[model samples]
Target: MTEPTSRSAPADQTQKEGSVVMQLMKHGKEVGVPSNELSSANAAADQKGQPTLEIRKDYMYRSTGRPEKTDMIKSLLTDQDASRNCELYLSASSNCSAVESSEDSEEDMYRDAEEIEREKILLCETSSSEHKVSVAPETDIMEYCRKEWRGSTPVAIRMRKGYEAVAQKFASIRRVRGDNYCALRATLFQALSQTTQLPSWLRSEDFTMLPENLLSKYDWIKQWQLKHRLGRKMGEISDEIKEYLMLLRKKWKNISEIKGPVEKQEACDKLFKNEEEEYSLYEALKFLMLNTAIELYNDDKDGRRVPVFSWLLFARDTSSNPCQLMHNHLNHIGHSGGLEQVEMFLLAYALQHTIQVYRLYKYSTDEFITLYPNDPEEDWPVVTLITEDDRHYNIPVRMCQETVL
Candidate 1:
């Protein structure tokens, strides 16, 4: 194969950099370009007693003496007076040598410019990640288990179940791929492993789907309707959440374009903003879950089957919708939306069973920190916990641990 070659730089300013400028620089304070030849901006600045050149710190102090102006040759050579600027060329270097030198200098400059542009593009991508939900390339589930652990290692969940002991104490990790609602999916699968009321859609072999995808599950949604004490009709709840999925689907295309905190906040607002015709996506889910939890309560008050969504109720008035203030349970982020943690806590609290959270991390040690909600008498209501991560990590589920095919 032919060797890769560098792109040629423009044969102008870049070529002039280390040539005549170097000769003038070597001459120290002697060879001075006429100050009149400076650019008008520089001329105006110089007349007002300002420094003529914005130069490097080392370039500021020359060998001989502190000159009134630095990089004078650079300014003069770059101006329109090209022919007059040739006087500073070194006599030792022939015209042919100078031409060759200029070519190399041009090539080097071009490479530097390319590198800078690459860095700028990378910076833009990094900054824009707030709104862009990145989906990794699809990988086989089997490959996930066989592959050697790289980057962030997956954490096995810790929960006590007499039947299975949470997947034989984390014997395997099944990676969930190709979806935005990963955290929600993972949590639901793990937390609801023992629940007899799990919807068939959740257990289907190919059922990796979001809440919006569940619009057809009438029976599952019925649970939502029966449990909701707010008495919101099931039809209304279904329509609101369907609209949310529609917005998110369209946004998958536009999200890459979103950048900065402001745009991200706007996107989140759009997800939560209810217009004249309908409620925001967030509001829709809030109400849907509201009804579902109510249904669970009515079904079996002693079982504490569903999450305590009444915690979402606001008896007092607020500036905004009371629903927005109930975001304390947890904030969902990842594939689509998530609430397995909040759901688990609500179910556990209702059933009078304690839930333990393992915030696994691979820092100086290969271990996880356990988290428990504070006592009811604390400043906050049920629980107030914050987990910080300085690095990336993985979470494995307890619901159904299967080997890759």
Candidate 2:
């Protein structure tokens, strides 16, 4: 080819063109285009025309520091009127760069704000919602005293007065008893001797008159003796006490056998009635049933066979309609096999207690059954006993065994 000339073009044009091509090559690398292909295209365009007059890549612009070369190319390619078009490329590049910088700043600001908001949310979630309060013992005592006497009903007023008297008597007895059973027993014996006929010397006359100051000591004994003798002989009993005991007995009997929603509601009502104000009779029954159920379950493990019918009796008391107590008992028993067995243990005692309760107060078992829908097969009296032999009893025995071992 005519001694392929190494002398190329003007240094400024060459440098300007080379810089633009190199920038294009760098951008090509960033966009994953072949750098070699771009270099070949640029070389071909340079060789085809006067170096200053050549048009290379379309994106090359004056703002990129190639103003003289770009202006020359634009003048050669178009009429004099086209000179204005050259500024368009310069302005577009400036605008694009500005937009990119602004977007980057906005993105950074958003990230920072999000991080702060996330930290604030984390702090809120970890903090406790309620403030802690420390209550003094004297404040609690005063509150209790206030609650005990706030109501002015005849029964409430009487109960408050009785409690005050009982508290005073209890304090005096505590002093005399001095927490010694032997001393109490001696005191009781001496009082017993004085209350009965005996020789002065032989009967220990020092125990004379049975000390009126010790009247508090004899309260329980006097009450018990009075109930045993006067209650049985005269057949006179306090209606309120009898009602309370009857309700308790019914609750003990009916818990496991309480099968339906209506009965459960009734039972729950009886147990929790006025629960906000005072110790409910239902609560006492529930406590007693829970204890009895646990005891029965333990006894069942020792091979003591208790009748299922007896449990039904215990669970079927109607005095105050103990369906709720029975329901709770059954719920615990069904979930805990140990509890179920304890319930079984209490069956006989519960049945006997139920009979006594029913004798004192009349209640309808049919009414209870009506409230509690009986299971099919007429197995109304039978409590379902889930034993180790039951295939459906899937509780892992190994875990319990491991604990025991």
Candidate 3:
């Protein structure tokens, strides 16, 4: 990380010009770098004796005695509350030796904000147009159930009725791996199946060329580049998110372009089963979830009222400072443990889509189907999933299955 620049004048003659020169800062005082060696920029309002702001070439900040300038500059560039929270997060991350040590592994890389900015994928020029839903073609429900259970237990036989019941209303079950990341995987599967333009919804205005008011209500992006600075490595966090989004868009388009359902499934299998693809998606999901939590926490803290995301705050050992809890969440990425209901709700909101989960229990009530966010602001695309135990999720592909009258 480059040292922060200083704000001192060489002489009264230079000071009268209202220009600020960059100087090496150390221990709260300017030193070392010669004034002539540093670059100079004239302040717009120098004649009025107002300090001109100079944008830092990079986002790294060092802990120093002079915090007021840093605070002021960040306040101008980002949401005030989010900026403060991100500072604590970055500070904590910079000191975590474990995080810094994981730079060698491809799965545990951390990226700098400047790097992300440089490689940022421009939104497709035609992305502004409406996206069509590339619905996953239906498959045989009984065949899917048989393949899933493999005649392993008597309970599996009884569950067939519930699967049939689901089949009556839907087309087929798009199976998801029964892992800790099932919910996220299931959601992404259904979401991507719906459209190849998922990036249009997921990319933050801060990171992409998006309109400010576009989906502003559900937009969870806020100083995310800073919040997601998990490691101190130069380029450890190589934009897994950008890579993941581009690949998904490509894969969805590839699947949609296919002529047959079987061929489409084969294409999906190729992408979904790839260990590298799964890891990239998981990392991207973790990054999005972590930053979303920070945005919500900052909102709640700023409002000082009944917490909107109180469900997420409770049920966890916060240890007082919520930021520490967030830090713990960041550390747990790529580790064991499934995402919680609050997180699913957050993901649903983040995607601006409704997640409908259907229970595959032998006996269930009207609550067999549940919707995240209860009420949505728009007619967002619906992503359907089926869960036998509710702990894991699988996409339910709708198709033209003939119903037995």
Each candidate's lDDT (Cα)?
Answer: 0.30, 0.26, 0.43
lDDT of 1 at 295: 40
- Candidate 2 colliding pairs, count: 15
In model 2, which regions exceed 4 Å deviation?
A: 1-143, 169-313, 317-327, 330-405
Q: Candidate 1 — worst ten consecutive residues by lDDT sum?
A: 383-392
Would you estimate the TM-scores of all the predictions? 0.26, 0.16, 0.50
Ranking by lDDT: 3, 1, 2
lDDT of 3 by residue, 273-293 (tens): 666665566656655554445
lDDT per residue as tens, model 2, 1-405: 011111123434534343323322221211111111124333232222212121222333344332221221222323333322322111000122232343344334323454445545744653443111111012222233344335444434443454343333222111111111111112221222112222122133222222221233323212211112223443322333334444443443354346664564345334333322112232223333433443343333444432332222232121011333344233222122112211222332322211100000011211111111111112112211111110111101101111100
lDDT by residue (34-118, candidate 1, tens digit) is: 1322454443333222333311112232342221223323232343333233233211111222323333443343234544455
Report the Cα RMSD per candidate. Answer: 28.1, 44.2, 22.4
lDDT value for candidate 3? 0.43
Off by over 4 Å in 3: 1-139, 143-161, 196-199, 203-205, 208-234, 238-267, 304-315, 318-334, 400-405
Worst 10 residues of 2 by lDDT: 354-363
Which of candidates 2 and 3 is the stronger one according to TM-score?
Answer: 3
